[model samples]
Target: MIMRPGHQQLLLPVNPFFLWASLIVALLLNMVPLGRAAWLPDLLALAIVFWSVHQPARIGIGAAFVFGLLMDVHQTALLGQHALSYTTLGFFAIMVHRRLLWYPLVSQALQVLPLFAISHVIEVAIRLVGGGIFPGWQFLIAPVIEATLWPLASLLLLAPQRRAPEPDANRPL
Candidate 1:
C-alpha cells in the first residue's frame, strides 16, 4: 500500500501483556457500578474493536466472546447477549482491519459506526426475544458515542506501540 505523507511511524510489536491488560481495563470500565444507562458507550466494545483492527492476530472472536460472557455474568443479562454482540463486532473488525487502517481516523470512525450499530441491534433483538423491555431511543446513542470515541481510543491504545523501542541520540524515528 502507498503511504500517505503523514502516515504514522511503524509501530512496535504489541506486547502480549499490554494487550491483555488493556482489555482487562476496558472490562473493568464496563463493570463500574454506574446504573444501566442506555446511552453509555461500551468501552469494552471499543477496546475490542480497536485491538481487533490493529492487532487482529492477538485479539480475536474468542477473546471477544470470553469478555462478553464476563459482561453477561456481571450485568446479569441474558447469558449470550453480550457474547454474541462482541463476537460479531470482533469478526467485523477483523474483516475490515486491513482496509480500515488505510483510511483517515475520521473516515475510519465512520466506517466502524455500522459495526457498533449492528452489534447494538443484535443485543436489542436478543433482549426483546428474551422478553426484555425496549431500552428506548437512548440506546441508539451508544453506537454514535462509541464511533466518536474511535479516534481517541486509537490515540490512547496505540501510544505505547508508537514509541521508539530504543531511543538513541543518533537515530530518530
Candidate 2:
C-alpha cells in the first residue's frame, strides 16, 4: 500500500473528494467536442494510475472498477467495458508499482504510457471485434499527453504536504 509521510495514519479509504473530483474531471474532459479529432485526454486513466501508485490500498482495483462504471455511465458507452479495462489496468499498475517508483521521470513516463494505451487498445479491440472500424491514430494521442503530464502530476500529488518530524517525548508520569 502506498502512503504519504504526513498521511501515515491515513490507512483508511480514499477521500471521497479525490474520487469524485477525478471522475468529474474525466467526465468534463469527455464532454469536449472536436470536429476533426476523435481523441480523449485519458484524464481518468492518469488519476487511477496516480492514486494507485501513491495510495494503493486506498485506491486499488475496486476503486478502478467503480470509477470505470461511472465513466461508462457518463459516456453512454458499453457497460462493463471501461470497468473491465480499468480493472485490468489497475491490477497491472499495482503489480508493477514498486518498480515504477524506482524509475526516473522519463522511464516512469515510458512505463505509464503503455498502461494507458492498454486501456484504449482493449476498448478499441473490443469495439472492432464487435464489428467496427478501427479508431484512427488520434485515438492514440491521449496517452502521450497523459505521459507528458507526469511531472505536473507528481507535484500535484506530493507538493501539498509539509510534514515535520516530531520529537520523541519521554516525560515521567
**Clash list (residue pairs), candidate 2:** none
Can you give the TM-score per candidate against the true fold?
Answer: 0.95, 0.75
Q: Write the per-residue lDDT of candidate 2 for residues 1-173, one digit (tens) a residue.
A: 76533343333344567655765676567556543254756767787887788677777999889888887787666776789888888888898888787666677888988988888888778667767677798888877888888767765655433222342455321
CA lDDT, every model vs. true structure: 0.95, 0.73
RMSD to native, candidate 1: 1.5
Report residue 54 deviation for candidate 2 (angstroms). Answer: 1.2
* lDDT tens digits, residue span 1-173, model 1: 77854676788988999999999999999999999999999999999999999999989999999999999999999999999999999999999999999888999999999999999999999999999999998999999999999999999988888888889998765
Pairs in clash, predicted candidate 1: none
